[model samples]
Target: MRFPSLVSGEFVKRINRFVCVVRIKDKEHFAYLRNTGRLSELLKEGTCVYLKEKDKGKYSYELLLAEGEKGILVCLDSQIAPKLYAEGLPAGELVYEPKVVGGKLDLLVGKELIEVKSVNLVRDGIALFPDAPTQRGSRHIDLLIKAYPKYTPKMVFVIQREDAYAFSPNREMDPIFANKLKVFKSLGHRVVAYNCKVSLEEIKLKEEVEVLWR
Candidate 1:
């Protein structure tokens, strides 16, 4: 994703509550804004960080991290994921629209009108998505199935982090999603789990990664 006013400088301090204040000059202060792609460890109290400054916030906008600094966007999936489809195999006919029969979708991949879920919770080489309960996640499966009776639309839980070989639903936290995913498999629709190699630079959709299914 492209961000405006990318700040390539050093980290000064995390001022206020969420603002990561940086020094571009003597009187210039650059605060790290909260955005989607920004990670926790990337912004240290005294670490060199690249950011994008936006004027859309009263106090701050967000900092878009450059992946090249850490090379997190290199693989996207399968740096730790199992093996499903190949990476960079060409997103042929993979439509990018949001339309579900019973509900709404996130994006479309060809005949697969799918929903994309981004998980940020990671621990010891494992990352789980939907840190909280998602009634919508459980419902997406039903909607996808209804959208394509001939072929079940795929619902991909895209884990957007690093150092994981597989992906799993947060059954303990959201058993509804887990149970629905387990039940949905009988319909012959695809439930894909993939990991994203993220950085301050870019977040890519990778192929040739591994997946775990019930």
Candidate 2:
């Protein structure tokens, strides 16, 4: 997807899950962070970030992407995951924010329920999810497991960056979520991971890659 007018900025500090401070053209401003994930590794002090002007939102600007290690651009917004997934997936009537047993699933295409996760953390060419702990993520998987007999469950990991060689669950950070993923896969559900070709112009879904558990 193509972003709006994005200006470069320096990330100062994150005030909370939704707000962050950034310096654009040497002027400080408050920016809205769309994702709630702990981005300690991605959004650091003095890190280069991309911000888009927001006239109707709570903040003046919204954070779009950030420059991580090795000049990689990581999309900070998690909402892009489901949108890209629905667009790239096979043709079907996509139900956004489908109500589930415990909570709302990301998308429901026909009889298939899919959960989309945006991945930005990568180490040694291996992409990982939930850079921090995610009990809600674990709950989603558990709920999916309970609803398996009636619906086809699938988990999609959308790596925001292009350089990741492979994708894996971050067991070190959230063991329960990782274990639940393993169980969900073992139950014959699908676990898919795909990378995106991200640039300043657009972010499009690329090819599907294998999901690495180890």
Candidate 3:
């Protein structure tokens, strides 16, 4: 997905889960953080970030990406994953924010329930999810497990970087979620993981990566 009016800024600090203060054009402004992850490894003081201006919104700008260690750009917007999928994937009746067994999933493509996850953490060519502990992620897996018989349940992990050779659940961060993912596979549910080729011009889903779990 291409960001039309994005501007470069320096990240100041995260005020809360949904908001962050950014220094744009030598002026400090609050921007909406589209990703809710802790992002302890990515977001830092003075880090270069991308922002998009909003004429009428809670914040003047919205946070898009941040420069991590080794000069790698990480896309912080989780919402873009599904948007990219919806734009690139095959023609299917997509129902957004569909309610599943006990929780809401990202989309319902045809007869399948799909949950989209944005991955930011990549180490040694391995992409991992839930940089922090995620009870909500675990709960979604549980709900998908319950919905497996009636509908095809799928979990899609979008690695928002180019360095990933494989994708896996972050067992070190959230063992509960990792265990539930194993149960999800054992129950015959599907897991799709793909890496994106992100650049200043556009961010596009490129190719599927192997899903590794133990």
Candidate 4:
């Protein structure tokens, strides 16, 4: 998706899950961070970041993109994955935030119950999800499992950068979530991942990458 005119800044430090300090034009400012995931690998001191000014909010700007190792740009907005996925499909094909048996899911394309995850953590060309422990993610998988034959549950992982060649669950960070993904795949549910072409101009779904089970 196309982004608004973004201002480039240097990342100072993350103050909390939703806010961070950034340096723009020699001035330090607080920026709102949409992604709740721990992004230690990307948001380092002096790392280049992109932000959009907020008209009226506690923070002056909102963090949208960050530079990864080797100058690769990564979209840090966790909420954009489903929208990117939906844009690729035909109109009215994807439903947003549909209420299910246990809770709400990300999307419903026909009979497919889709849960979209935003991935930005990459190491050695492998994209890993849940940089931190995610109990809610595991619970979502369980709900998908319960949906079962009534609706085909699917997991869609969107890596927010083009550097990753493959996607995998972060077993070291969240073993339960990784195990649940294995069970979901074993039950004949579909699990797919795609990498995106990210830039200051736009971030779009590029190509589907291999989902590594191990």
Q: For this target, which candidate reaches the highest lDDT against the unseen true structure? A: 4
Q: In model 3, which regions exceed 4 Å deviation?
A: none
Candidate lDDT values, in order: 0.54, 0.89, 0.86, 0.94
Report the lDDT tens digits of candidate 3 across residue range 1-214: 7777689999999999999999988999999998888898788899999887788978889888888777877888988888877776565688888987878888888778888899999888899998989988988887777887788899999999888989999998899999899888887788989998887778998899999886
**Candidate 4: residue pairs that collide:** none
- The sequence of per-residue lDDT tens digits that candidate 1 reaches over residues 110-154 is 555666666555545555655667787778777876786644477
What is candidate 2's CA lDDT for residue 189?
A: 95
The model with the greater TM-score, 2 or 3, is 2
The TM-score measured for candidate 1 stands at: 0.62
**Across residues 1-214, which tens digit of lDDT does each residue of candidate 2 receive?**
8887789999999999999999998899999998988888888899999988887967899999999888988888898999988886666587999998767889888889888999988888888998989998998898788778788999999999888878999999999999999999998999999989888878988878878877
- Cα RMSD, each candidate: 6.5, 1.2, 1.5, 0.9
* Candidate 1 global Cα RMSD: 6.5
RMSD (CA, Å), candidate 4 to true, equals 0.9
Which numbered prediction scores highest in TM-score against the true structure?
A: 4
The C-alpha TM-scores of every prediction are: 0.62, 0.96, 0.94, 0.98
What is the C-alpha local distance difference test score of candidate 1? 0.54
Error (Å) of candidate 3 at residue 109 is 1.7
Q: Is candidate 2 or candidate 3 better by lDDT?
A: 2
